[model samples]
Target: MAQIDWETLAGRVENAPSLLRLWDALEDYAQACRDVGCTEAECGLDLRRLPTYGGEWTGEYLFPIRDDGITIRSHDETHMLLDRERAEPRYVVVPRSAYNL
Candidate 1:
């Protein structure tokens, strides 16, 4: 069985007082989630192998968001997740010319 740190995640900084702190907290959680996919029952799929933004934009991230089955795209797309609880979908395009970036 894979190990998931519920402690560090329990007291997450979802709404910290500082911007840096918030980003740092978000980045931490993003990295952790990327490292270990969402095990939340809210996410029925196994996304423990998805990629998270590493504070860099060199490559692209093309993974599926478990909460609503929306495609998460990075790399020049600058995609964002909106109303994960909603069913409406958004588009994320990756240009063929991005390979050179």
Candidate 2:
């Protein structure tokens, strides 16, 4: 799995508070995976109907971990990023999808 830098992520979603919590959650999930001896690629955490942008939007956070990186995606038209460590969790905030449907 790939790793990411937290500072860079904090830059992108600095205004999105919920994403910060989501970031912490992702970290916990990653740690849990390590504790269980599961590969990050095989790990996932599905967040259903999470509130974002101060209730302006609500969507699911689909976290699919991979050997190369981890994706923090929303079921709606959005996504964000959070990082771990060297070459084990490179994160990327996938810009919001253009289509609503």
Candidate 3:
């Protein structure tokens, strides 16, 4: 797996227009990785392992977005979630098809 530069990612996220667009960029990157035959683990772009608020792992790619103290909701439809008020976030690009799963 490739090492992530948290500081760099924080900067990018801070400057990004929206989390959804950032997710798109990640999806593109993951596609490029697969084009070269890199596995999700080897490419270090597994969305399932992404970190979430309070130092928790997502376990799956899509989940819910809740307020600082509210409960998280799970949706059956495919989409990406973002929490800007929590600790700094880290993300990776996965194919769009990953969202359908």
Candidate 4:
């Protein structure tokens, strides 16, 4: 597979019509990175450039791990995206580990 431009993916997520689509695309990307054996550094997303809102959305929503060693807290943008009260979805570039894929 060709190297996916992070900027392009970020743009797509930003323009996505809904949160569902954003998550779908992000999940797919995470899978692709895993398939290609991407390193953690290579698979990380720049969270600062993504959108965020107010709320508490845990990382467990995306990656559920029972181990006590693992702590899942939603990234700022993810927190906003997970907000049930928000009509519009937010976007964020989370690391591969964040997805736990």
lDDT of 2 by residue, 1-101 (tens): 46644444333333335655555555555565677676444544333333344323444444444553443443223444533234554443444442222
Show model 4 residue runs off by greater than 4 Å: 1-7, 39-41, 47-49, 53-101
C-alpha root-mean-square deviation, candidate 3: 12.5
lDDT tens digits, residues 1-101, model 1? 56756556434443344333433444455445557665332322222322233344443445444546554433223333221224422222333243322
User: By lDDT, highest first, what's the ranking?
Assistant: 4, 2, 3, 1
Q: How many collisions between residues are there in candidate 4?
A: 0
Best by lDDT: 4
Q: Put down candidate 4 lDDT per residue, 1-101, tens digits, no spaces.
A: 57767666656655555455656565565555567787323766543243433345544343323433232223444332332212222223344345443
As a whole number from 0 to 100, the lDDT of residue 23 in candidate 3 is: 55
Error of 1 at 18 (Å): 0.6
**What are the Cα lDDT values of the candidates?**
0.39, 0.44, 0.41, 0.45
- Go through the candidates in order and give the C-alpha RMSD of each one to the true structure: 11.8, 9.7, 12.5, 10.5
Evaluation by TM-score, superior candidate among 1 and 2:
2
Q: Which rank order by TM-score, best down to worst?
A: 4, 2, 3, 1
Whichever of 3 and 4 has more lDDT, that candidate is 4
**Model 4 score (lDDT):** 0.45
Q: TM-score for each prediction?
A: 0.31, 0.36, 0.32, 0.40
Quote the lDDT for 63 in model 3: 48
Question: Which pairs of residues have clashing backbones in candidate 3?
Answer: 26-93
